[model samples]
Target: MNAFKPYPLRDDFTLKNRLVMAPMTTYSSQDDFHVSEEELHYYKLRSKTMGMVIIAATSINDQAQAFDKQITLKSDDYIPSMARLAKAIKEEGAKAIVQLHHGGRMNNPTLYENKEDIVSASAVPAPREGMVTPRALTEEEIHQTIEDFAQATRRSIEAGYDGVELHGANTYLLQQFFSPHSNRRTDAFGGSLTKRMHFIDMLIDRVNEVIKHDATEPFILGYRFSPEEIEDPGITLNDTLALVDMLKDKPLDYLHISLGKYDQSSMRDQTDQEPIAQKIQTVLKRKIPFIGVGKIETRESIDHALSLGYDLVASGMPILVDPNWGETIQLNQPIKTVMPDTLPKPLYDRLAKYRERFQQSGYEFPVEND
Candidate 1:
C-alpha cells in the first residue's frame, strides 16, 4: 500500500490514498451548463477508487466557456446541480475538487457574438487554431475577474466540495496573464515577471478572503500551473521558480504541476538537465505539498513519480480506461491500459468521436477488442 497510503493534506483533511483522478474535460454536461445525468454517472464510476476526484475544468462565467458542454459556476442557480455532482464523488469516500477556469482569449467567438467580449491581460491571440484575437482587459475588468473567482469559490463552498483547484495551467486565462507571449500590457498586471504575477496574487487573496468569510469547514485551495512556455520571452523555468517561491508562503494546500511526463526535463532555455518537477521541488522545499501529474498509469510509473519527490500522483487516461484502478490494484487484478469497447454506449460513443483529439495530446485510446 505504498501508493495507497493516506496523505494528510491539512490538519482538518486527509486523503484515503495518494492517487488522484486528474481533471479532464468530458464535454458531457447539459446544454444549459448544468451537470448532466450522464456526467454524474461518469464521475460516480471513477470516484470510488481514488483518493480524490477533481472534476473537469468548470467555467466561472458564461462568457468564459471554452467547451460546448463545460459546467458553470457563474450563478447560484447552478448550485443544486453542482451539489449533486459533488455528492456523487463524496458518496464514494473520495474528496471532491472542482477546477475553477476561465477561457480568456481561448473562448469561442461565436459564443460571445463579438470578439471584443473575449478579454485577456492583453490583446494577443492564442497560438491554437480557431482562437480569436482578444481585447485587452482594462484594470477595472481585471479586478472584476478576481471578484468572479472569489464568487465562484463561495459557490463551490456551498456546493459541498472538499476543495477547489485554480486552473492556472494550459494557456487558460491565468496562464495567459503570466505568459509574456500572451500578456503584453505595460500595466501592473503585465510587463515584468513580478507584474505578470500580480493577477494570480490578487486572485489568491480574494479567494482566500471568501473562504475565510463563508466556509464552514476547512476547504482546500490548490493551484495548478505549467512550468514553462516555448515562446520567446515567455514563462521560463527561472520565472516558474520565482513564482513557486512566491506561492510557497501562501495559504495553499498543494501545488499541482501540469506536465506531459512525470520525469520530463526542462522545457525552458535553462542549460540544467534536472527534471522539471525536481527543480520545482527544490524551490518549494516541502513548504507545500506537490501533486505531480502526467502520463502516470502503471504501478511502476506511480512509484517512479513518487521517487521524484512528488507528494501525490495523478492519473487521467488510465482511469478513463479503468474506473476501478485502485480497487483492481488492491485485489491483485490487472489494470486496463487501453480503452475498451464494452464501455457504456454513451461514453464509448463520445470517446470514439474525440479519439483523434485525444491522440493529438499523445494519448493512445485503442479499443480493447480492436
Candidate 2:
C-alpha cells in the first residue's frame, strides 16, 4: 500500500496518503462569487477518500473573476464562505487547499462593467478564439497583483485551510508572464526568460512572506504549472527545465505538473525522448516532492506514476466518477471507473461536458443512465 503510506511534506505538515484530488473547476459557486451549497457538497462528497483536496481555481481579486460561478478570495467578506468550504472538506479527513488564481486575458469581458478592466502580462490578445485583447498591466499593477496573491494566502489561512496552491498553469496570468508568445513587455517583467520568471519569483516570495508572518498553523505551499505550450515562442521543455532549476531551492512543499497524460512526451521538441515530468524531476533532483497528474483513473495508473519517480499522484476524473476511490483501494475492492446513475443530479450536470470529452479520449468514465 504505497499509495496509503503517509507522506511528510514538512516537519509540521504531512499527508495521510499520497493520493491527491487534483483541482477541477466546478463552476458551481454563486453569481456573487461566494461558495455555494452545491460546491460545498461537491467537495464534501469527494473528500472522504483523499489525502489532500485542492479546490478549484479561485479569483484573488474582483477583476480576476473569469467564470460565472467562480469562487473568490478577494475580500474579508468572503472568508466565512471559504471557511465553510474548508470545514466541509477537512471534516472528511483531508487537507483542504484552495488554489489562488487570476484569469488575466482569459477573463470573460462579459463579467466586467468596463471591458478594459481585463489585464494580462501584455496587451496581446489571447490565442483562443473569441478572446479580446487584454490591457497590459502596468509595473505597479503587476506588483499589486503579487500582493493580491499574498492577501489571498492570508485569507486562506484565516479561513482554516491547510494550504494554498498557486495556480500558474492553464494559460492564466502566471503562464502569460512566463510565455514569450503572450508577453511582449519590454520591461523587467518580460523579455529574457529570467525577466519573465521575475513575476513568479516575486509572487512566491510574497506568498511565503505572508505565510511566515501570518500563518499560525502548519501550512503547505504548492505550485502547479504546465510543462509545454504549442506556440513557436511559447514554453518549451528547455524553458521548463530552466524554470525547474530556478524553483528547486524555493521553500515549496511540492511542484505539481499539469498534463493530460502522466507519461506524455514534450509537445514542442519531438527530439526529446523523456516524459516532461521525468525531465522536470531530473532537474529538481528530488529537492521537493513532485505531484504528477493527468487522466489517472485507476490504481494501476497511480502506481505507475509513483514508479516513474513522482512523489505523489493526483486524479481528477476518477474521483468525480468514484467518490470513494481511496476507501475502495484500502478495502482491497475493485475500483469503479465509471460515473454511476445514482450520482447527484447537480454533480452529474456539472460533469456532463467533461464526461463526453473523457469518453472520446478513451478514458472510461461512462455515465450510467439516470
Candidate 3:
C-alpha cells in the first residue's frame, strides 16, 4: 500500500492522509490537565489537516510527572476539563490520542522530588552526571505503577479521548525498564528480554482491558520506544526487535520509533542522529503501523518516509513552530524551515526552566505553562 495515499492505521481507524502531529510536551495545561484556549487554538489550527493528533505527554500522576505545566490524567476532577479538550479535537474530526507516562529515573521535580527512590527494572544510576542515584522500585510499587497507567488510560477515555499512547520512549519509566543500562533487576521483571518485556506486557494488557470493557472502536494503543540508549551501551536493534516480536501477537496498534535515551541527549551529540523512527519501520517486518519523528518539516521528507514503509508520518519541530503545518502543507505553502537549534523552540525553553525548578525546589511548578 502507498503510505502517502491516505493510509488507515487500523481496520476501524484511519487518517485522512498519513500526516500525524507528533505528541509533544507543551505545558499549556497548568495546574489542571485541562486544555487552555491557546493550546486549544494551537491544536485546532493543526488539526485542520493532520491525520491524527496525539496530545502532549500527560503525566498519569505526580510521580510520573515530567514538569509543572505538563498535561496529565490523574484525577476525576481532571476528567471534565480534558473531556472538553477531547471534544474540541474530535469536533475537528481528528482522532485524539494522549501519551501517558511515568518519569522514572529521569529527574522531574514535579513528579518525583529528592526522594531518590527512583523505580526502574533495577537500581541503576543514569549514565548522566549530577543526578542523584535512583532508588529501585519495590515489587509492590511496580504493580502500582502498572495500575497507574491503566487507570490513566481509563480516565483518558472518560475525558472523551479516542485513544492513548504509551509514553514508553524518551528514557521515561517504561523506556528505563527496557534499558540494560537502567534496568539491573534480578526478578521476573528484569534479567532477559522476556523479563524486560514483562512491564510492557502488563501495561498493554491493562490498556486492552479498558478498550474491551468500553467496546470502543479500534482505539489506538501506540507504543513509542527507542532502539537504544546513547550513554549506556548495552542495547541494539535486535534487542528492541525481540520485544517487538512479543508484542506482535498481542494487540499493539502502532510503534512510534525513535532512538537515544532522553537524558543522553543532554550529555552527548545524540540529537545529531537522523530521526531513527523511520529506520524502525524499515527494520521491522510487520503490518502494524510505523511512524518517524525528529525534525520532519517538509512534505518531500514525509512522502519519502511513506515510500520507505512508514504508515504514519509525524513532524515535531514543524508542529512546534507552526501548529498549522498540516494546513499549510495541504496548500503547498512553504513554511519557515525549522533548524535543529530552533526546532522545538517552545518546548526547549520550557525544559530549561523545568530543570532549573527541579534543582531549586525538587517539587512541581504550581502553574500551567501548558
TM-score of each: 0.93, 0.94, 0.83
RMSD of 3: 6.9
What's the true lDDT of residue 335 in model 3? Answer: 62
lDDT of each: 0.86, 0.86, 0.70
Q: What residue runs in model 3 are displaced by over 4 Å at the alpha carbon?
A: 1-5, 110-117, 259-283, 337-370
lDDT of 3 by residue, 1-370 (tens): 4434567678787777777888877766744556666667667766766778888888786577666577778777788777877877888878888989887777553355456545556667667665556778888988888888888888887777878999888888898888777888889888887888888888899888987786455667888887665664556656776877776667778888663221122223345554344344445676677776655556666666666556677876556556577777666666653222332335545655554433342323223333
- For model 3 the local lDDT of residue 174 reads 90
Q: Which lDDT tens digits does candidate 1 get at residues 90-163?
A: 99999999999999998877788777889888888988788889999899888888898989999999999998
For model 3, the run of ten residues with the poorest summed lDDT = 259-268
Give the better candidate number (1 or 2) by TM-score.
2
Question: By the TM-score metric, which is better: model 1 or model 3?
Answer: 1
lDDT for position 351 in model 2: 66
Candidate 2 runs further than 4 Å off:
329-347, 360-370
**Candidate achieving the largest TM-score:** 2
